[model samples]
Target: MNKKWRWTIGISSVVIVLVVLTIIKIGTTQGAKPDWYSAWASAASSLIALIALVAAAVAANATIQTNKTQTRQLAKLEETQQSDRASKFAVWRALHPTRDSQIYRTFFHNAGPLPMYDVIIHYFVNGHEYTSKEETLPPTSTPELVKKSDNNLEWFIKKLAIEEYGLYQPKTKEEVAAIADLKKRAEAENVRIELVRAINEGKNRYVKDIRIETGVSFSDGENTWYRAPNGRLERTS
Candidate 1:
């Protein structure tokens, strides 16, 4: 029960017992009982009541403390569960022939117990870094490719030509020959791709990076990227 009720009941009980003892003491004193006997009995009764009050207070305090501890433990367990569920991975893979330009797709699936938040995929193609332009993927969900046409394909084509043929430009008479050589070299070289992502899981955050490599040697599919399990061409006609 509450402290006020406990105190009231305890005081009433002590007072009742003391009154009965006093009555008995008076009766005995009239029949030769020592005068100090009544004094000793009253002191003993007061002491007993004080002890009972202290014990009740202690028990109530202990119950309150136990409840607080249990509450903290339960909160901790809930946080742990959320963090576990939120664990996820975002993989970047190149879409082969989905569009005219080679596009990379960032796909995510929840690998842990909690939901993923702000799962942004940052990628690098041929040494230039680029962030995903689309919204972050949620838990267990795979999002569409972060469309990037910022980097001009024509500029990249020229760079590839310069790197392979060691010529930035060709004369008008040799223009056809240069064009043929660039196309031939571009088909033979592998495009270097790298992917990384950052994700928020509750109060914590994690960043991860994966190496992107061609599936085979320098060939037709060598320029494409793919994530494990399901990174293939998805025709969205």
Candidate 2:
């Protein structure tokens, strides 16, 4: 038999043996044996039974306590993982300034005009740099920029929420002039330029996935938030 069943049978045997010994002693004391031996035998059987019962109770309680400890430990581990994920989300939100890129991203998911946003240069290809520029989809405006790019794989975005993603604005003549003046004063960093277009809702529905497409440099897996050249949430790619 199994170890547990063996233990149970052994304990039962011990109890039965004690009871039989007690009965025999009682009978002998009334006839052949002395009264003192009978009394001692009865006391011994009672003590053994009490000890066995106490041991069994302790064993059962110990098993229950161990199970409870394991359950609590697992719960604590899950809570810690959830807390870590939440902290990461907060960090990303602080770093990525979506509002500075465009006003629509700052307020609501506008389905009209695209908001201008910023992004760091992922890298330069030839003379152009790849960046995740901020783009917006303003409400009431036709999101033709994205729709017409259906043939263009590079311009495809999964979903475009109004005011959700940011937009990128081009460098103005004044800004370029400022850059020239700054070069005469001191050589500043060269900024990359990119185009951002707004997307329409339900226009090109597909597999039901919308990704943040600032340009070639966009990384949805990035933990960091992007910023624009104008010190806004949006940046040119």
Candidate 3:
């Protein structure tokens, strides 16, 4: 029972005891009835009515509070259920042939319980951005089911070297001499091999000076969400 109900019951018991004592005193009196006796009886009746009203109000308030608590719990449960499956959609990266392979590829995988719609991926490599979209991506439990992108790490780095660093294939003797001079400067500066290979092919040149980041936005038919590169997921709509 509620604390207010307990207080109400205690007050009602005390008032009943006082009213019983007053009635007993009236019954025991001998000659002229005391004027205060009628006043005490009327006051007792009024006190009982007031206690009843207070008890009723307390009961109603408790009911309202209980309902509010239940409503909040139900809303929380519904939200958890809706996001459970969508949260499992993720972007994964792996190197082809082996983990130490120079060629790295990005893939879209839905380990979620449900299929995602309007799946869009954004890739950022050293500030250069690329976007790709798909109509739907289905959930999968195996690696073979994951979808790969054509724009891999090797492609992105090569593009960056050509566009940002102004590295290109030499067709003339002058252009070739310029590349040789650039390579000498690069070697003196201890530049990373991946950048060097972007200008001219070399062995064991891996992706360096390239920072890759990915983000994804998709839907579960009812709601939309976005997942950042750091794996933080949030609802967009």
Candidate 4:
């Protein structure tokens, strides 16, 4: 089963055959074997030994090549695993409502070790898709805040509360109904969001399994940004 045992068996078989042939030659010549017969048998034994050596060399070379291939495959697998581990990103949201003012401050946080780039949070409302403006969210140690009202919710609230005269005031019955319907649509849809980062060579990384309540729409003159998942801002790609 092993190389040593196989070599031992092959060599023993060859030696046994040589001894048997020698004995036969010597017997047929009545204990005085012809020189040519001995020479032919020696040549045959040498040829067999050479064949065994070549076979062993071939087997050893094949084994070495196989080991090299396996080593390279293992190294590649480890590299892929390390890349996955280092590139993982997670998005988190926290609601910090001020008790006195009833100002609902919703903070979107990046919870992973890696920095997230072009982190567009996508939300679904009544089967329609909306996305947050592409932004970079640094790692957990350096949290970024999103002013929900200024950036997102207040627009809807203002359009509803303000009359045609443009004075800011409380919402009328119809406005209240519209706001309630919007809230219902948002909650009913559950607003699944995607946080994505695109990189050089068109490679993309996404923060998986996190959901947010709202999505943003980018205006015509918005800025696009990029960053490496593990490091500082990447100015290109």
Candidate 5:
């Protein structure tokens, strides 16, 4: 069926035709066979044997090549399966209802066929970095919401406001009245409330203007992996 087989069959047919013609010539001879007949028969027999050997070698080589190709394909398939199993963890995001909806939450999910361990997430909010507590995630489990109280954007902004402008939220009616009077005095003097001014000038902008970057690192008991904010997953170990 293949090229090598086709060539082998064609050569064998040609040799048979040559033998048939030699016999016919001998039969039609007017006397004893010609002197070259024995030598010609011997040479033709050797040629047939050589062709058979070459055909056998070609068939063996083709079988070896086919087996090598199949081996490579099976190895690649196994590598792909292992990669799928190890790269099943992901980081998730959602808004949280707190501090007037000025904060968000980070979550982790394990969608793989195995459990992930020592999971940690790194967050960068407007260039300020924060890290989450380590945890373990089970395969095909529900997404785990991060609950660190100090890890929210609202807390970061409040901390900055207090450090830079001595700003604090009023907790009582008297404090509220005091802040209101202070605002009125600033307005009368055509001056700005430092905290309010900073917020309005976009120095401490809202969530829409905030840039948040996130990445996650986890282990599959043998190797570690990191998933970047842009969804690029790579092995770390």
Candidate 6:
């Protein structure tokens, strides 16, 4: 089964055959009976020994070659495992964007109407993820204080857009639901609205998310703005 035993067995068989033939040769050629038959037998024994030695050498070489192939295969398997782990990590980071560490800044309103804009914060959301798109903020105050009595809700929404109009980013049908959800959350919390919406308002493709501007809209058609982690103001894309 093992190389050592296989070599021993092959070598012993060859030596035993040669020894037997040599002993017979010496006996037959002792005296008055010089048998020529013993010489041919001795030659045959030598040929058998040479064949067995070649077989042992071939078996050893095959074993070494097999080990080499297995080692190479094992190394490749480890490399593939490492690569798979790294790819999964990249995908997760892309999705969440906000993992660990302080990587972003934002602003929002706390509560109440015109005379108070309580808290204007600049803090990090999630450092792990980057924006898939931009989000807009809620209006600063509700229509409860407005003078319009007809269709109070719509009036209030329009007023909020005009007065604190800084928070609105035009919405596609799909984004409308998310905006509504944000409004509901803002009412329930009774605090400043926090919105990070994606936009394509400019030539900058990298500006995917914009924080609310609190109370400012651009001149013609641009109103969205990006707040970097250090509070640098940027025109939205």
Candidates in order, TM-scores: namely 0.36, 0.27, 0.65, 0.36, 0.55, 0.27
Which is the leading candidate under TM-score? 3
Between candidates 3 and 4, the lDDT winner:
3
Query: Model 3, range 144-217, lDDT digits (tens) per residue?
Result: 32344444445555655666556653344443445557767555434434445556442123246556788888
Q: Quantify all predictions' global Cα lDDT against the true fold.
A: 0.44, 0.39, 0.69, 0.47, 0.67, 0.39
Rank ordering of all candidates by TM-score, starting from the highest: 3, 5, 4, 1, 2, 6
For TM-score, candidate 1 versus 6, the one ahead is 1
Error of 2 at 188 (Å): 14
Model 5 off-target regions past 4 Å? Answer: 1-36, 94-103, 122-135, 148-208
Q: What's model 6's lDDT at 209?
A: 46
Instruction: Give model 6's TM-score versus the native structure.
Output: 0.27
5 against 6, candidate with superior lDDT: 5
- Give the range of the ten consecutive residues with the poorest summed lDDT in model 3: 200-209
lDDT of 2 by residue, 30-52 (tens): 85667767676777678677767
**Candidate 1 wrong stretches, greater than 4 Å:** 1-32, 88-109, 112-118, 122-237
Following a full C-alpha superposition, what root-mean-square deviation does model 6 have from the true structure?
21.0
What CA RMSD would you report for each candidate? Answer: 15.9, 15.6, 7.9, 14.9, 8.4, 21.0
Between candidates 1 and 4, which one is better according to lDDT?
4
Q: Write the per-residue lDDT of candidate 6 for residues 135-179, one digit (tens) a residue.
A: 222234322211121123222334333333344444334445455
lDDT head-to-head 3 vs 5, winner? 3
